[model samples]
Target: MAQEYGYRWGHSGLTADFDLDGDTPRLVRLARPGDHDLKGAVEAALPLVDVVLLGDGTGWSGPRFTGTALGPRLRHRAHHATYGDGWHHLTVELQDPASRLAVFVEYSSPDGVPVLRSRVRLRNDGAAPVTVRSVSSLLLGALPSPDVLDVHRARNDWLAECRWYAEDVRESVPDLGREFHGHDGRAGLRLAGRGSWPTDGHLAMGAFTDRTDGRCWAWQIESASSWLWEAGEADHHTYLSLGGPTADDHQWRHVLGPGEEFASEFAALALGDGFDGALAALTSYRRLIRRPHPDHEHLPVVFNDYMNTLMGDPTTRKLLPLIDAAAKAGAEYFCVDAGWYDDEGGEEDGSGAGGWWDSVGGWLPSARRFPGGLRAVLDRVRERGMVPGLWLEPEVVGVRSPVAAELPDAAFLRHEGGTRVTEQGRHQLDLTHPAARAHLDATVDRLVGELGVGYLKLDYNITTSAPGHLAHSRAWLAWLSSVLDRHPGLVLENCASGGLRMDGASLAVTQLQSTSDQQDPLRYPPIAAAAPTAVPPEQGAVWAYPQPDFTDAEIAFTLGSALLGRVHLSGHLDRMTLSQLGLVQEAVAVYKSLRGDLRTSVPFWPLGLPGWTDEWVALGLRAPVAGATYLTVWRRGGGVAELLLPVPHLAGLGDVRVEVLHPSTAAPGAGRAEWRGEGVRVRLGEAPAVLLVRITAGG
Candidate 1:
């Protein structure tokens, strides 16, 4: 399709229309190929690059934004691209003649994925310096109006991460009635995250859908630092913009010297028929962008002695039995959680009273805790046919740690006024500094090479606020890549006090992500079900802690939470009875049988994106090639024993067959499933129970 005023390029599974006829080359449409042309639906004109210079302000009369003024004045210079390795890259050049400030909009996408990744680069071409306040990685118009569109967002926090909610666009940005007012509304809904914990306040993702038509657009800002996104009415239609840390939202600013360039963090967008479709597309894109690792494909079971089991107080005597039990349960990796380096015998056993909280940083095993050296425990792990793993929070040095004093002050992230920044009794390490990077490299090399450790649970516990967080974040990502390059086989788990740094930039380089530190088995369903929205199922490590005291239903409930994703098994299996251990073994056996499908399957929520306190929740994984569908349903204390869970995608198959994989029918209150019209009705006699069922078509 050719545009009369500009050009329309539809290739490699995506469509992008540019209005080159104007002084500024605007992205008129970004959607699926052969889809409806948005040229007629575009109610407002928006520049492809939303940038704010030092002097130039908003062109509109309402909220300050990077939509107009300097953006609209940028003249199109050239456009080019490259292609290889199942990926396509395109770059559009735009420059401001007055200030000699040049902007480059870069876009990339996988061969067949319905998602586009975008970013912006700014350069100073003039002799004078150019100060930039804000720049958007992606900006687009022609979205559905508030009257017919609904927006979905997630509020993230420790233990309660990935809590999704929906609201009408009018709820956030009131219906200004642009037609009657004779102008677009300036006010919009702005969502942002500050500090090093990128997802501490809210997720760097959002989606909007047409209620009647089910058309949806979902997006994620792939930044490990501060980010901001906004949506509002523009020219009768809504527009959405994504960006990294901005001057107004995060106290970030940069003065680009002559011939200097700066790149914004990447953002991705996916279009689909509904929320599930968009999320499934996003899942595929996530898999394509992440670093390739055997762990993602094998989907190994990790037994970490944290959460409700060890609680970060690892010792040889405490871990040996657990290691044996985990090996018997079919866990491929055994991880010794925190407190491994606590030389001081703090008063508390599993509590923070044990210098474990404030006196960290020396990645060494404590002789006092591990009587025969940590090597003995590690050797036992290997002897039991499991890889040894250790936990390390490499980004921070405790105030009481000697490493803090050994490294120079410049190695730590400092405030704008040159003061060392501290949070939660730890000083943040600035990976941009050579000394800090060296220290981390040494720590990891010793853990992997010297101690024969195969896996490392890299954690970031503190949230430090400082200027230039975006730059620091990029440096951190580079360092992570370097480590993986040197130790190609070593596995790294990206954890930030449990899912705080759950962003694409971080997930792209790490093998696994801790979905949450939520301890309660009952409260973990929503997090586990929604984690695929931010991460691929293979990379989202969901904890399944089944204790000896738990009943058969309780055990099934905990283990079922992680059946569809990467299983991070915890709990004191060492003390469980034969029957209890059998239950745990049964769950692991089922997981291993179907783990291969996780790498290729896309996620769907039959119960709709779960609510925090919803009584019932359902997550479906459908493998397109295998012609198989697996569903995990959790019933959290509701009287409803039967649920008619919708599975429209699988309903097309004429004959559907169901099988209960876990807690076989012989078990008390075993759940069963049967296909019905457009869905399957699952039944569990108990209120607090879980069921894992597999359905096949044309049986």
Candidate 2:
């Protein structure tokens, strides 16, 4: 065995050092190769694994570890390392003498990728059982103090999502003169989430960068529900702890019997030069971990007749014309959104409010809406050179739905004892139940086998927070993977009331993510520009709905929102004039030509990340191998006519060419772009206008 003093593990582009000289091994250094080594500068007193049990409460009364006694008593036992499939896996086992709990801090990282995935495993070696209250998937101490670090977190909500804001860490966790008190403060910044909608209130990611230097670190917790992350001062040094469900916050308790083992959720961390660099690394890591799909490569443009068009009320008459228009507009997939399965003929006014909300679980086409059978509409979609799709919310059964009564009570999620969990008159399906999984499998198989649904917009509109959310979440992903495994050709789009459940876990299994439900043409720019921060560009499905009454500028503004990401083309194209429709067609064409590079490209913000109400916003996709860069700039109601977007990569390269790729004929007050010193200067004379530009080196 290696000496129990200092140990180092080095792999592709990553270096980790542990201080085994102490009673408990401490992860003193973790960084990119040749980066700063965090040792001696700060004490290696923090434990590599932090755990909180039912009776062994924290040593300190805070979200961090100062109060955790078990953490300090966890002595180094043994470690094993292995490599397989271009990934390095390391598990360090530690034993708490008093509790006789064997904790394994497991870590895995892809070769040459500056990203690490962490999780914890626990095996009870004691005579009696122990209840685990909370455990950290990854915890790091001795981070740069708040004086030199600025924390970055995104504010998320219904339509407003991925809005990032940066603040000085000192402001959030001020210096409390702990030297005088000899103890860490009891307060810190905590970003947490519960319920079924993981990203309902906030995203499961955060970052911190040095104020002077560009060094930065970012991390994301991969959990569908009930997760907590906190950054606080421990022994005067900053510490970050990330974990899944906890008893204190989510009423999650796991009883580990003798010899029983349990594993926590996975969390990933990456390091880069700055926010953009870190996010780019994270973007690459997201691509690495996601399920492989042809849709990611082809990036087929989907036209959903819901937002700003049919509004979920679909019928044979209403969809036939739209299908033809969508085909003409270059959409490769046509998805008939919600209300397609409304067998209960209530009121059909284009707005899906009548029987659509509470009477949902049959997954059958409406005979009344489709008098000639839904196949005729689907056939029309296929004839238009587009694949057919349907909307489904498989995790819920409406109170009045026949399937709700047909399935046994055990099929639905419930409280710890027995009561079923209901949200908004809908019972949540627990995929952990074999019966629930079978029901969903049957529904999906029927849709794909019988109706020839090549695509499915799997939406979850209800939120439930019953006990056993962690297990149910894992089973849900397993069920989704199993469905995809069986129906290999079927593409799934993950949507939860628009970006509510946008997490790495869901995106890893589903092919596409609906970025938002924002209907207004003017309000989508910010969301579109920052979507790639949480989702890969090719996987982020952004809606572009252009109405007939919209001006040329309005049409370009909305369509430009999706050019850099997956084109979720919506709107009443059938009603649009030829001139108005031409713009949509041109934008779709531009997306197709650019999408091939998006899968391999990395996103960058020439002008720092956009603000919620920023007058101007820009999103860039740089394909290094292709030697091309695409920029989509939106000028939304501002007096500033010119934007100097810095493209550092193109800086100092002589004779660069900038071309407006969209809006074939510019509007009356059109936008213009040209090569400047180190960036492109885009001038848009009109408000609410957008331009898609291609930049390349030229003679």
Worst 10 residues of 1 by lDDT: 345-354
Q: Compute each candidate's TM-score over C-alphas.
A: 0.97, 0.97
Model 2 over residues 259-346: C-alpha lDDT tens digits?
A: 9999988899888888888888889889989999888878899999989888877888789899999999999999999888886651
Residue lDDT tens for model 1, 21-49: 67667777777865665445543657888
Off by over 4 Å in 1: 179-181, 346-353
* Candidate 2: residue pairs that collide: 58-67, 59-67, 59-68, 60-67
**Candidate 2 Cα deviation (angstroms), residue 213:** 0.7
Q: What TM-score, to 2 decimals, does candidate 2 have?
A: 0.97
Clashes of each: 0, 4
